[model samples]
Target: MMKKPAMQKSKQWNIKGAVHLAGIFHFLHSCGSGCLVPFLTLYFRHLGLTATMTGIIMASKHLLALVWRPISSVLARQYDKRRTVIVGSLLSSALVVLLLLLFPSAGIKAESGRCNTSQPSADPTDGSDFTTLESINIPSQSNANVYSVNHKTIITEQPDELSSTYTPTLVNSSSNWSIRAIRSLRNLEEQQEEAPHTEFLGSLKVMDAQQQMFFLVLFVIVLWEFMAAPLEWTADDGLYEYLDFVDATGRHKGVKVWKQLGAAVGTGMVGILVTKLYCRTGTVTEFYSYTALMILTAPTAALFPLYLRKRERATSGGFKALQLVYGNSQALLCAITVVLTGMATSAVSDFLLWQMQDHNAMEIHMGISLALAYLSQAGFAPLAGRLARFLKYHGWLMVLAVISLSLQCLYYSFLWGPWAVVPAQMLAGFSTGALWWSVTSQCEDIATPGTEVTLIRLFEALSLELGAGLGSLMVGFVVQKFGLKILFQGISVILALWSIALAVLKWKIPRQRRINYSRLLAADTSEVSESESDQEKDWLETAMEDARQGNKWKMDKF
Candidate 1:
């Protein structure tokens, strides 16, 4: 009797220590990618890719996740190699950053030679400063990348100010190009008279260089997504397995708050690094920081422990996770809700930076806003579990998340300047922190016991990726045709309506507390026949037996 009590005490201590160690790894992993992921759109635009092109490349991540994530999860499950996958994925992420670093960059500032230089603010009444400045950089040589100030030009050729990592923006007919347009045209004509062929050749070279960079960036992103697809799901799946081992899954949300904290630190660090060095830095600071952090965490991931129970159940070998989604209406609804909300959320994640750029928001504004947003998530994440209790149903949490997504779109739609992003993003923190907690936790609750291979059900994540990819691909076109402001407003309205549809559908469809652990894995598309069902027992019965065995054997130690 005394030995039994002593063993229980020792086991409790072991679980406590194990979870804290796990939190440290989670913190480092979140910090690693937080440094660069948020700023990627700005990075692409700086490289002279059009908005539509950037969107397609960004969207490829989610679209590709459909293939790679599943494959990664299966590989991890079969080989019991979750730790190996995590380590490999993190190292791959670091390599991707190093490859991106080989290209010259200067924060998010436009490179001097690129045609997308920011024009100086002019008093519309005077117009002289704008006109004269536009003529000075009118390419004494023909190096046209097709951007002009109202078909005019602009200048700031200081080597320190014009590093290759600068963003060049499009100028439309609506731009304030008056005397500057005329002066730029006159200078261009004279320059062309002297060396027309030379200018033409230079333009060809510039366009060729831009094209090369565009393709290179796209290729890098594609490879990066494929290699890193396993990182999050694999890591989180391992974490969940560990939690279940200790019977401490309740503390999962509270521990995950550490991730938000680490992300806040990393994002704040890089945001400050980039914003402060917008002119002085020759290298992309975020990549260096991101690489260092990823390297820092890879070793921990390699050694992380995972729990893989023996397949003692009769219905073991098939895609039971898939059948859960198809047979259950509530689970299916959860998938749909996640996908639609994922698309709406993409408006803020992928393209909000474009809107901020249009408002002349500086790096500091971007950095500070996003950092605070992350911090807000960290602050609020612990409360989500309690809030779910008050809200009664976990599904209500989804409705709240949808509402938050809609409000975020509405805020960005009417943004006046960069400073507003700071406050607006605070709400984003809750959406990601509390709301995201709600999204994943609710799905976790809905899944049948012992079917987890990737934290949430596989279909839940797939639906999310599908929504995000579709959103990014289509949102790019809207930004191209209607502009960023109009795009946000439209998305806000559409998402508002979507939230209502979800609420109504959720009301009508009953939530599936635990899906039937079916015996007919081979006939996933077909219903289980009574005769076949009679031969087999529900997975929960086996899971209970496994639990008794696990307690008796004390871990079935891998």
Candidate 2:
């Protein structure tokens, strides 16, 4: 008896150690991702790509990333490879970034004199019409580089951090691309009056060499996301499996909180680092930080504990994982909501920093604002479950999330200065995290017992990549055409309509459970025709048993 008790205690210790390890690894992994992902759009913009092109690239990259995630999750659970594969993915992803850094940046011709102080002064009337560069360590641009962004007249160079996948930046290119770009556009009569109105966004011909350079760099970034895929879903799947094995499932929230907090800290650290460093080296420093953080994330992943269960893998199982298993009304509605949420997320993730730069917000301000968003994410993650339970699955929370996100997007339109981001982003967690929580609850409530992990990852990719990718395409083109403010306001209006539509659907459509076709098909009607014989009873019983056992949906009484 004493031996049995001692053995149980030792086993308990091992489980505890494993959970702690999982939490630590997640924290570090989130830290690495936070350092660069939030600012990726700004980086592309600085490279002279228009928002439209940026969105196209982002959409393609996200689509590819989506493909990788499902495969990664399947492998993690089916093959029990999450432990080693997660680490391998992280290391390989870091290597890709290292390669990205080594590839020389193209078309950025930096020269000595400040963005030609000799040019005509910009109009003072337009509050939104501030140059991307003022006096602060602005980089000189080649005319080719400036013309490559969507064709707007008010030419300006971006700050170096212009953009971390931007620390987009406080450092200016010493080059004079902005000046020549302004002059070139001014010479065109059709575009002259609209120049200041279009302001920082000016169109360059698609055939420009600078434009082509953007595609080249985008390809490399896409590859990085592909390699990073295994780290995203696979890591979470492994950790969840580990938790289930040890009966420590409740610890999942704590792990998420740690992950959010780590991201908050990492973004804030980058903000402060950008501030303390010279403008010239700010973006370079960001790349180094990004590369180093990802590298550091690798070792912790190597230590991640994944408990792979013995299971049969087949084509049917893989296909099932990808299919929608919930009711038609609710599942489809939630999927739409998730996509809308993705659009909002992608717009904010890619362009919020660009707007801040347009408003002359410092690089540090951009960093801290993003950090605050993560902090809000950490705070709300714990409360999400409670919020969902209190609402009782009516999807009221999801509607609220849509409204909140729309309001958040709308608020960006009214920002007068850099300080505006703080208030706009502080409550961001509510809109994003809440929608995700409510959508995820739908998946959890209906998921077949053993396939919960696969289902959750499937939905996650839909929201994170599919929705976001489509949103990127929309936001980028809109911003390029109408400028940032109009684009934000338009998205807000669309989301408002979406929220109202969702509310109408919820009010009209009654809650229905996922239909069990097997059970329904197996129901007997023999009693209505005649008294059952012994053979008939046995056939009915066998069919019922097979239905209960989760066999084919079609049942034959004969």
Candidate 3:
């Protein structure tokens, strides 16, 4: 008996240890991710990509995640979740390093100084203004290099033997020297093309190389992002599954607290690092290197999951076909609310930094804005959990979340200064944190038994990634056409409409019934004891009858 008790105690200890380890893994992983992801757009812009291109790249990242998450889910089930996490983390880290190496750091150099004279007297027949190049001064060339100046053209002297060398063909134009004229003049002197025009040709080459490098880097980042998706699934699904095993009702709050705290510290550290490094060096290359190094350590935390014993009830085997289990009208409303919430939050995240930059916010200011957003999110996540408990109904919590999001959107739309973003971010933090936790809990409640993790992953892929990807594309186009202020205003209006719709749905739908565990347990125990007592009474009666029969037989024999 004592041994049994001791074994039970040891098992509980191990379970607690595993839960804590999972939290640690989340913290480490989140910290590494927060460093570079928030500033991805800024990094791209620094490379001279336009807003539309950057938006497309960002949207592609999420779209890839949306497409691959199902595959990742299957893989996680086929292989050990721990092993999947470790492999994914390592692969993602390696890709990050490759991305950094492939990124085009050196931009195209500016053209050398050249002379331009006023337009020469127009010919009376044509009456068109035409500029003439009087004397050209190429900063890179020495005075020893011979150049002959014609009426309006400059030609470099070349050796007689090389004069007949093949020249690139150019279109014929009678107009004064332009980019086209430069192309035409190239055919006159082949040796001079290699000598005097090297800088121009080199600049063009660099530009082409940069464009290729940009696409290559984007490809690598996308691959890294895809590899990284498994870790997120493992962390979220693992935490919920672990909590279910331990029968911990407050699982979300407990795990989220640690994760959020780590996120806060990580985001703040990133802000500080970027501020100091960018201000000092005027480049984010060092920051990327540091992020890569930090991510390499993520596998260390990931290894802890290897020690976690898989739960018997956990989803396993090849991807099982999920049965469609529809919920009530209220559930549908909640689902829509979650999707819209995701869309609104993602829009803000995708563009808030760019908006700040447009307002002339410094690098440090941008960092602070992101830091504040994350820190506030961290603080509110636990609080949101508590609020959910008090509200008791998930729909009310969803409404609260939508209201918070709308307020944040309104604030951002009218925000005129940099510091004003901090408060707006606080609202955003509360809304997102609350909405995520609420939707997750509600989904767990409505999901068929043994399908909680699968449903949650599906919901994440559909609502979060899908909504985010679409929002990114939309925000990009809206910002491109309508401008930033109008974009936020539109978001605010959409969110406001969503909130009103959710409110009406809540009013029309009845509250879901809650289960009474204590009453059910009492009834089960009563039935079991009564059945046992009846069985004992029946056995006693049979024994008495047998004894009576034996006495009657002996009397008859005598």
Candidate 4:
């Protein structure tokens, strides 16, 4: 048996190993998936496809998920989380690689029939091949092989076409090869001009129309994951708008336009730090601390769980770890909250604008709201990951969200005009950024028994997508029927109640008791027996032996 100190050391090492693995896993997935959001539409345009088609194709991911979620959840619950993760990652990656490879070939085929180079061949023996030769020489039949004429060089001719005094003559082919070549060249030039101006779009231009469509679909799904879905279901939207108000108000004219530039510098700095620290520390503590910093900031930070889920699958195939942490119940609850809150908020906003019979006024409010919405989601995603690490639980985070949203709504309702949303935006920024990260972290933290990470993630994903789709549709119906105040009032009540529910849940699962070992380790033995690879078992055994030999400590908490 291992000594006490050795056991402690082993536990510590395991937790650290798991955390580090999780962090790296999250980062890579986020980078790959998130990069597409800002560029997908342009990619579609490059393929000469329409926006309507783009939207339908993009929306299909969610539709596909409707099928995938239940199946994924059941499989994850029954099988290994890691295997599920591997399957999902491989599925997505294979599709991506296939698309990249398939695009160019498809594009070439698309251009194939439209362009060609060869001209029809002519036969010299054909009657049509012989045009009347006005200037010709006749040669004696006996001298057909070699004929000569006065002041003329000796020439040879076929026996059938003997000419004495033979003079050299040239015949132009029936077709103007040069003119056809020029026209062909001109067509090529026009194609070059009309090939959708793909240069500015980079390599995506080389992709085929179907691949472009695929890309648009995948990208929109990714965006919905990061944007409309997460916020609509969670209490984060209020925070997002509020923060946008802050950033907008905080900046002057030039700063707002150049905001992404500033963001670029900041992102670069964070990337460097993440790379450096992940390389050196390679521990959960290091990963969490770094993630905390990003999460608290909002946008990039908000993307933490997504980053974690994808990366974990990519690197370790540890989808089970995620499943053990956040299960179906929590996912269902989160989905309910998202749908209800999104519907309430959107309906309220629409009703209020309609009450005034001011469509333009509503549009202005929504425009600012939409812009702010986009800014926080796009700008602070990395920061949100960092914040999630810092905060630890959704319950405490929810309190903060409620307070910030309440303040912003009060401003919008009474204290401020549409412009008043500016100062209140900061509250939104903080809440949204933190809320996004915290919710994901909590979901990961509270997985129920036998849940796989993939199942949890898919459910989380489906909830967000379905919720947003439902919210948009439902809110439209409500606003058309009811007045604006009623909508706002309903949203306020639902948001407040969501805050309460979260607070209660948090009270039951505090920071100290955050980790749920029962769920996490519930099927530890069975999992080890069935799925743990020989290599993984050997590593664990070595770690255990090291602890027994007084070289390491037990590591249980991660």
Computed on alpha carbons, the lDDT of every model, listed in order, comes to 0.67, 0.67, 0.59, 0.39
- Best-to-worst lDDT order: 2, 1, 3, 4
| lDDT string, candidate 3, 1-558, tens digits | 355444444544365676677777667666666666776776666554555666677778888888776566545645556555655565556456445543543232111111122544345222122222322232233322222222323334423343445232223323443433344343423334555545665543323334544576677778777767666665565556556666653544466666666666666677666556542344454356445645565655555533345334434421331332244555566656766766776778777877876665655666666666667767776476456657655557778878888888878777677676887777755687677676676665455445555656655665678878777776778878888788888888888888887888788876442233442354555433443345445756777899999999999999
For candidate 1, write residues 92-168 as lDDT tens digits.
87887568755532123343422323765556543222222212233434534343443354332322223335433
Q: Which stretches of candidate 3 lie over 4 Å from their true place?
A: 1-13, 94-101, 105-214, 236-253, 285-296, 306-325, 385-392, 513-558
Can you tell me which runs of candidate 4 are displaced by over 4 Å?
A: 1-335, 342-369, 377-394, 402-420, 446-456, 509-558
Q: What is candidate 4's lDDT per residue for 1-558, written digit by digit as tens?
A: 975654444322233333333334334333333223222333343343433444444345445544454444334433434233433343334234223212321111111122232432364333211122211223234433222121123333334432343333313322343233223333443444467665677456544335554565556455333222222112121222223333321111122223333333333333344334432322122223323432332333232121112222323223564443344445444545544544433333323323322322222343344345335644655565444445543446545665555554444444234444445544555555444445555554444432333433443444345643454455444434563344455556657777787667656642322335544465455433222235345656777787776643344321
TM-score of each: 0.69, 0.72, 0.68, 0.34
Show the lowest summed lDDT stretch of 10 residues, model 2: 162-171
Q: What TM-score would you give candidate 2 relative to the actual structure? A: 0.72
Is 3 or 4 the stronger prediction by TM-score? 3
Q: Which candidate has the top score in TM-score?
A: 2
Candidate that beats the other on TM-score, 1 or 3, i.e. the better one:
1
Return the number of clashes found in candidate 4: 64
Candidate 2 residue runs with Cα over 4 Å from true position: 1-13, 76-80, 102-207, 308-326, 385-394, 513-558
For every model shown, the clashing-pair count is: 6, 35, 0, 64
* Residue pairs whose backbone atoms clash in candidate 3: none
